[model samples]
Target chain A: MPKSLVSLLIVLLSVLFATAQTKSSSAPSDLPPGSTSLIDPEDLLSELQSQQGEKPLVFNVGPSILYMQAHIPGSEYVGATSDKQGLERLRTRVKTLPRNQPIVVYCGCCPWSHCPNVRPAYNELQRMGFTNLRVLYLADNFGVDWVDKGYPTTKGQ
Target chain B: MRRIVLVIVVIAIAIAVYEAARHSSHAKGHPGAVDSPAPQFSLQDLDGKALSLANYQGKVVLLNFWATWCTPCRGEIPQFIEFQNTYGPQGLQLIGISMDDDAKPVHEFYQQFKMDYPVAIGNANLAESYGGVLGLPVTFLIGRDGRIAAKYVGATDMTALQQKIQSLLQAR
Candidate 1:
C-alpha cells in the first residue's frame, strides 16, 4: 500500500481504539464504590437475616411508594424520595434507632447518586452521629440486584 | 383607572416573559431531542405464565423495576400487590419486573408474599431497554397508548399512585 493510505488506516484504527477505551472506562464509574467490593452476597444475606433477631435498623427512602410494596423484611419506610420533607422524616426515623447499631440504607428510586432520597437520608444519619451506615448500591435498580441476590423480601403495605 | 390598567398590563407582560423564558430554558436543557420510546419486553412468571407488554394494551400499566435484596423494593411489593388487587379489575395493571439473578429467592419471595399479580426475573437486556434502570423500585406508568405517562424513580405514594391511575383511566 502507498504510504498515504497506510497512514490513513493507522489514524482510523487509533480513533476506534480511543472510542473503545472511553466506553469501557465509563462502566466502572457508573457502579457505586461499595458494589466493587468482593464481599460474598451470602455473607450479606446472613448479616441481613441475623439482624432479624436484633432487627438492626434498615430504612428505605424515596418518592416512589411502590418501593414499599416489596422490600427487605423489618425495614422501615423513610420518605418519598430525598426531598426536604423526606430528609426530615429520615432524621426522625434515625433518632429511634440506636446510634451504635447497624443501619443500612438504600433507595431504588433511581441510581444511588441521583436518588433524591437515599443518599441524603444516609448522609443525614451519618451527620447525626450514626456509625454503622452502609448503602446497598444495586447494579440496575433494587429489584435486579438485591431481590435477584436472593436476600429476603416481603410484599405489600 | 388608567394607572391601574398600565400596572396590570406591565405585570401581565412580565409574567408572560418569565414563563416564556423558563419554557425556552427547559427546551434547551432537553437538547432538542424527540422523546425516546420507553423500553418494552415480555417475561414469564415462575408458574409458566407469560406476561407481555402487549397484554396491557389500552390500559395504563405500572411497571415496577425492583430486586429482592432491596429493602425499598421489598417494602414496595406489598403495597404494589395491594395496588394490583385494588385496581387489577379496574383496567390498572401492576407488573413487578424483578431484576433478580437467582430464581430460588424470587420463587420463595413469591410464595411467602402470596403475591396475586405477576412477578418475573429481569435480565440485562430488559434493563438496558428501560433506559438503563439505576435504582430499586423504579416505576414507570405507561399510558393506554403505551407511552410512558410518568416515571417514579424511588419509593412512591399509594394515594398518589391511585390518583394518577384514576386520572389516566379517565383519560383513556
Candidate 2:
C-alpha cells in the first residue's frame, strides 16, 4: 500500500474515535451540576408561546437587561438579583404557576458556576415537584449569546 | 403635494424623537422612588390574628422582605432582631414579610432566631403594591408620613438601617 494512503486512513480513524468518545460522554454541556432536568430552547419557545393564551409564560431571573432588552414574549418579569421585593414577586408567581405545564427559567446574573438565581429556581422547582422544567444555560449573559442568536425576543418587562 | 410630503416627514421625525425620549425615561436606572409605597396587605399570623401596614400608621416602619430558607436573609436575622429590640422603643417597627413556602420552616427559624418582630406570609398583591420584590433580603424603610423613605434590596447592615432611620426620623 502507498505510504500516503496508509497515513490518510490512520487520520480518518482517529477522527472517528474522537467523535465517538464525545458522543458517548455521560454529561451534556450547558447544564449545571445536579441538573436532572433538561429541555431544548426551541421546544421551550414553542411551549411558551402555546401557553401564552392560557397563562403568562417564561420566568426571567435576575435584574439583567435580558428580561428587559429581550425575552420570550409574554413572559412575566421577576428579578432574581434585585431586592427582597423581586423575590417576593417571583414567589407569588411561582405559587400560581400550573405544575403540569413547562416553565423555562434563565438568568445572566452569573455564569453556571456561581449563579445565585438559576440554582435556587431550579432547586425550588424540584422541591415543588415540577415535572416539566427547562433551564436555558445562556453562555455568558443573555444579550451576548441568546438574543444575539436572533432568537425571538420581546422588548420591555 | 410637495409641501404636504415635507410636513409629514417633519412630523415623523418629531414623533420618533419623542418616542426615544419616552423609552429612556423608564430605563432601569431612572431613579426617583423606584421601590417605595409598599403595598398594603393584611396577613394572619400563625396565631390567626391579622396585621397590616395600616395598623402601624403612626410609627416609622421597616418592611423587611425575607425567607427563612434564604441564607443571606438568615445571616441578617440576628442583626434584625437586635435592631428591632434596640430601636423598638424609639418607634422603629420592623415588620418581616416571610416568603417561606412552608410555615414549619418559618416557625422553626423564628424560634431559633428569637425574632420579636411580627411576621406574615407574603402574597402577590402585597408584593405588587410594594413595587414587587426582585430578589431576597429586600428591606423597605417607611417613614411615619406613609411614603417610602428608603429601599434596601439585599442584606443590609444594621448601621446603615440606623442611619436611614435617623434621617427619616429627623425629617419630621
Candidate 3:
C-alpha cells in the first residue's frame, strides 16, 4: 500500500480511538477527573477557521523546540507542565483570563497516553475550576495531526 | 488567463515545498543495533559549534539524551560531570544531547549544573537511531573503536558507568 494511505489510516485510527475513549465507563484511571474533553483534530481545525474573534486561547504545553518548529496559530507556550517553571507559567497565564474562557491545551511531543505535559496542564486548569478546557488529541504528534494537514501554522518562539 | 496561470504556478510550488519538507522530516526505521557502529552526527552545541560523534573517535564517548524538564535527567548530570572530571583526560568524552527544543532554558540548566561538556540539540532522527529513545536520560556508551558498547534507558548507575568507561579506556 502507498505510504500516504497508511498514514491516513493511522490518523483515522487515532481520531477513532480518541472518540472511543469518551465513551469508556472509566477514565484513563491514571489521569485526573474531568480530563476527557478531547477536541478532535478536524473539529479543532474547523473551529479555528470559523471562529474569528472569540477563539479559545490555545496553549502548547510541549517542548520549546516543537513550538518553535511549528504550532497551532495563536497558541502560546507556557513551558512544559513536567517542569516547575512550566506549571508556574501556566498558573500565571490563567490568572488574567476569565475562569470560563474556552481553553485548549496540547503537547504532541510524545503520544497522548505518555505525554507528560498535557495531563498535568489539563488537570491544573481543572483544579483551578476552568470548566471550558479541552485537550487537542495528538495521538501521533502535532506535525502529523495539525501541520501535515496544512492547518494554520506559525514557526519561531 | 494570467490569473489561472498564476494559480497553477503557486500550486506547483506549494506541492514541491511540501514534498521536500516531508521527505527531509523523517528517517526510515531505526538506526541499527547496539553492537553495530554508532551513527555519525553533527549537532549544534551550547557555544553554537558543531559537535560531531565521529570527531570524538579513539575516545570512549558517552552520548546522553536528556531534557531540562526531565527530573531524572537532572539527577544524572552530576554523575556525568563527575565522570568527565575524573576520566576526561583518560580518553572518556561526554556529550549531552539535550532533548529540549529551546537553548535558553538549557543554558540556564547548564550553568546551574556547571556542566563542562558539549551539549547538542537532539532530534527524533538521532534518538530513533539508538533503538528508539522513548524515555529521558537514555544514554549510549560508544567504545574507543566507535561501536556502541551499551545503551541505558533510564538514570544510569555511576559505578557501573564508570567501570564500563574504565574498561573501554584500558582495552587494547
Candidate 4:
C-alpha cells in the first residue's frame, strides 16, 4: 500500500477505536459484574427498615439538586459520581472504612439504563477493594421510585 | 338520640373516605391534574430574562422539565426546537426548565443544540409544584386557557405531543 494511504487508514482506525471507547465508557451497563449486583428499590427499603444485621452505609451519587429535593433518609450525598471530583470524594469518603463494610451507592438521576453516576461510583469502590458493596436499583428516577412510593426521604442539603 | 348517632356515623365514614382518596392521590406524585390550572412561576432564564407561565398565558405552552446530562432529555431537544419553529406562529410556546445542578453544562448544551426556547434552572419547589418532576423529560401541555391539558412522564412520544399541541393551539 502507498505510504499516504496507509497513514490515512491508520488515522481512520484510531478514530473508530476512540469513538468506541468513549461510547463504552459512558454506558453503565458496560461495567463488570462487580458493579452490576443491584438491590431492588423495595428490597433495599425493606432492608433499611428491617434494622437487622449490619446497617449498610448508603450514599447518594446523583445531582445535588435531586439529592436536595428528596433522598433516602440517612443517605449521604457524595456529589454526582460521573464527575471526576465526585469520584474523588467517594474514594475519600470510603477510604477509612473496612473493605468488608456494607455500602450501598445509588443515583436516581435518570432511568437505570441511562444513569451516569452509579456504575462509575460502584466501580471506583470496587477498585478500592471494597468487598461488600451494592448498587441500589432505581428503575426510574429518585422522585418516582423512592419519593413517590412513600419511602422515607429527607429534603435539603 | 338514634338519629343523631346515625348522622355522626355517616360523617365519620365520609371523612375517612375523603382522607384515603387524598392520600392515595398525593402518594402517586401527581399534583397537576388535567383541566386544572397549571402551576405558575416566574424564573430567570440563562440570559437573565424573566420567564413565567403567566407571561405565556393565552398561548399553548409545552413545559418540559429536563437536565443536560439526561440522555433521553438530550434526545428530545432537537424535536422540541423543531416544534417551536413549526408551531410558534400558531401561538405554541415551548418553555424548558432544566433540573441540572449547575447551569454551566446547560449553557453549553443550549449552544450546542441551538435551542431557541427560553430555558431556566428549576429548583425543588418548581419541580414539586408540577407534581414532582421525579424523572427527566416530564412534559406538561398547557392549553390557551392556562390549564394543563396533558402530562407525560419520562421520554415522551414527540408525534403524539405535537398532535396535542396542535389541538391545544386550535382551541383559542
**By lDDT, who's the top model here?**
4
Docking level for model 2: incorrect
Candidate 3 regions exceeding 4 Å error are A1-61, A64-79, A82-119, A127-157, B1-32
Model 2 interface Cα RMSD in Å = 12.6
lDDT of 2 by residue, A91-141 (tens): 777786678666777764333443456666666665777777767655334
TM-score of chain A of each: 0.65, 0.64, 0.78, 0.78
lDDT of 2 at B51: 79
User: Candidate 1 residues A73-150, lDDT tens each?
Assistant: 777777553457678777766677678777776665554334445556666777898876666554345655565444
Residue A75 of model 4 has an lDDT of: 94
List runs of model 2 lying over 4 Å from the truth. Answer: A1-157, B1-38
For candidate 3, state the interface root-mean-square deviation in angstroms to 1 decimal: 9.6
Off by over 4 Å in 1: A1-157, B1-37
Give candidate 4 regions above 4 Å deviation: A1-27, A30-36, B1-30
Q: Give the fraction of true interface contacts kept by model 1.
A: 0.32
Expressed as tens digits, the lDDT of each residue in B41-115 for candidate 2 is 789875567877898886888888777645677788888788788778878888888765457878888887788
Supply candidate 1's per-residue lDDT for A102: 76
Error of 4 at A42 (Å): 1.3
DockQ ranking, best first: 4, 1, 3, 2
The candidate that achieves the highest TM-score relative to the unseen native structure: 4
